[model samples]
Every structure is written in C-alpha cells, then in structure tokens.
Target: MIGCGIGGAAAIIILVVTMAFPGSTTTTSDSSILVDPTKEKQSLFTLARVMIQNTGNIPLTNITIDYGGGAKDFIPTLKSGKTIILSPPDGNSLQFVRVTADGGIDVYKAYREPVAMPGMMGS
Candidate 1:
C-alpha cells in the first residue's frame, strides 16, 4: 500500500512538471509561402515577430506584409527556400499578420499566447 502511494505521488509530480514546462510548437505547411507569428516577452514588454519563408522551387515576387490599420511593407523578390523576419510598425499591437505575393501566395497567421492551466491545454 505504501509503494502504491509513493507511485501516485511521483506521477503527480511528473504531471505538474510537464505542465509547467511545455514543449515547443512547430508549424508545417505544403504551401509555397509560410508565415509564422510569435510573441516574446522582453523585460516588461511583449513584442511580436513574424517569420516568412519561401518553400517553392522558384522565386517569389511582389511580396507584401499587411499589419492591419493601413500599415504595409513590400518585398520585390524572395528566393526559393529563403526566410525573412518582420516587425510590425511601432506602437502597433500585433494581433495577426497577412502575407501575400504574386502567383497566388497568401498566408495569414495569428499570434497565439500560451496559457496553461490545470485542466486546460496551452495554446
């Protein structure tokens, strides 16, 4: 009976540790353009960063990054398998990002904040 109790306690400890430190997240896509947005906490402020990658066999052209509120940036070309990082305009809270380019390459991604609770899954 004592061994059973010890095993149960150990299981609980492992579960709690797992919940406290979650695993990394990975985004996979078969599309020509991949857009990923993430938020990082720095000091006392949270900053958002976006990563764009070209996965096609050919180069892309006329790329645009729309940050909502009429703020946008453009890229003339992106070589195949190339990646770039973008920051939203100053004083803008990054809720989501939309990327578009010629050849029907369009990708929209939202920033997901991680929230872990006892009975909830982290996002």
Candidate 2:
C-alpha cells in the first residue's frame, strides 16, 4: 500500500514538471529573414508556394528573389515583421532560391520536399 502511494505521488510530480515546461522557444535576430515553403505539392507545373518574412528590426528594400534558371522577382520594400507569399515563374523548377536585398542581406536556400511523419505529437 505504501509503495503504491509513493508511485502515484511520483507520477503526479512528473506530470506537473512536464506541464510546467512543455517545449523550447525560438527567438529571431535583429536582421534576420525567414523563408518557408509550403508542404503541399504545386499543380500546373508551378513552383511551390514560399513565404518570405522580414524578421528584423529595420525595413528591407530592393529585395530580389532569384529562382533558378534566370527567373526572378522583385520587391521594393518589406517592412519589419512583414510576410509575403510568392510562387516562382512558370517553367522554373523548384530547385533553389536566392534572396538579396539592400544592407547586405543575402540568403540562399535549397528546396526540399516535406516528409510525412506518423505520430500523435509533432516536434
């Protein structure tokens, strides 16, 4: 009887601790950019939808997005904490993306397909 009570108490304590600290948090930098691609596949032979966010303190200007094979797009300004979604030009493969802007902001990311995971909780 005493062992069962102790075990129950321990389980409760573990549960409380887990609830207190569930997951880790992430913070962005002062001059950072986020480039996220949608998980679903694109139809009509177009590139996947991509999200571009100015996760920075200051506004970005003269932003240029270069999709592979001489395809590109331009954005005059992207204010701080702003997000935009764009699709590459038709006939351009979703191989990679290179972004450049004023103030020496440059980023290059390769496209990768999302994987399916079988689980109740995701990370």
Candidate 3:
C-alpha cells in the first residue's frame, strides 16, 4: 500500500525518507529532475508515471514528492509493476512543479490546459 506524503509538497518529502527502500538515502536538490506533459487529464488529474530504480540493490521506502515553482502537489502512489501513478492538485496552473522522491530531485511540467479530445471529427 502507498504511504503518506500525498499532498502538500513541503512535508511530503520527510515521510518518504522514512521508508528508505533503496537501503541508502541520497539527498536531492529541487533543480535536478524533470517531468513531461504540461497539463493534467480530466478523468485523472495527472497521467505521469515515474520509475524510481534503486540501483543499489536495495528497497527504498518512505518516498516523498515535492513540487517547486509553487504549484500544488498530488497524492503519492507506489511504483507498482515499475510504474507509479500521480494525481494532481485542484488548480489549473501547475506552473512546472518540482519533485523530490527519496531525496531524488525531479521537475514536472503539467499542461496548463487540456487539448482537444477525440470524436471532434465528423461533427
């Protein structure tokens, strides 16, 4: 099951570190990693899946995610089957929020707005 550190970027990271899945913990800065897709989906807030590999041959628990650029954060989920799902905040302007997991830094740019959906054709 996924643990704490879902919303509110600041306090999230601390909870993640407590898990320490990767055996060793490495602190990451805000400007290190980056995520794609500038907007969130309607049925779902965010469709971004982050793959965190504990290359050190250990399990890293207590993972956390922080969003910089002042954008709100989302609920945290485990990377099941190597893919972790993320839900976005209520606001429309994500404004390129940053991410920090298990002390690993990352940046995500969610679309300000969604694009046209399918079935618009033949109208």
Candidate 4:
C-alpha cells in the first residue's frame, strides 16, 4: 500500500515536469509587421520595410503580391529581405500582401497609393 502511494507521487511529478515544456516543440519568431489602415500622405511617404526570409531549407521564387482585392496585381517574384513596404492604394483596394515560399501569403491594410516612397513620390 505504501509502495503504491510513492509510485503515484513519482508519476505525477514526472507528468507535470514533462508537460510544462515539451522537449520536441518548435518555436518561431514574431516575424510580423503592423501598420495603420489610414492612407499615407505623399509628403509623408516612405518605403515600407519588408522581410524576406528563406524560412525553408530551399530557395523559392515567383512570390505574388496583390492589392485592392485583385489577384491580378501580384508580383511574380520576391526575394528575401529584412523589410518591405508600399504606399497606399489608388482606389478601393482593401488589403495589400506578399506571398511566402510555401505558397502561403500575408496581407496588410496600410495606407499608401502608388506605393509611396521618398524618392519615388510625384514621379
């Protein structure tokens, strides 16, 4: 009877410790950029930063970008970078986004038309 109680206590402790933090778990970075949904002024325009990470073991290409809710506005290719940005849309575009290497995509609702930039403004 005393041996049974001891075994139970040992099992409970082992279970708690292992369940606290699983050994085989994988962690990922925040890896996200948040921006306001309002339109940016041309006078206050800057290049939005975009991060391009390999993420996977192999390289990827033909990343598509679409904005204003149109798949036709996608970029054919995008490379890995630390920051990516674009000016607000010209018309009724709801979101802007970039595609990931695994065919996954991310979109943003920031305000920028013609993809505002410091030097590219009023071009």
lDDT of 4 by residue, 5-114 (tens): 99999999999886553322111242322222333344555333223333332334454444445533333444433333444344544444434323433444333334
Q: What is the lDDT of residue 29 in candidate 1?
A: 39
The true-versus-predicted C-alpha distance at residue 7 of model 4, in Å, is: 35
User: What lDDT would each prediction earn against the true structure?
Assistant: 0.74, 0.71, 0.39, 0.41
lDDT of 2 by residue, 32-120 (tens): 67776543453433337667888888888898889879988999999999999998776667777888887777777766555435652
Clash pairs for candidate 2:
none
Tell me the tens digit of each residue's lDDT in model 1 across 38-86. Answer: 7765556776777788877778789998988888989999998899988
Q: What TM-score does prediction 4 earn?
A: 0.31
Off by over 4 Å in 1: 1-31, 114-123
**In lDDT terms, how accurate is model 4?**
0.41
* Distance from true location, Cα of 24 in model 1, Å: 16
lDDT of 3: 0.39
Decreasing TM-score order of the candidates: 1, 2, 3, 4
Q: Which candidate tops lDDT?
A: 1
Best by TM-score: 1
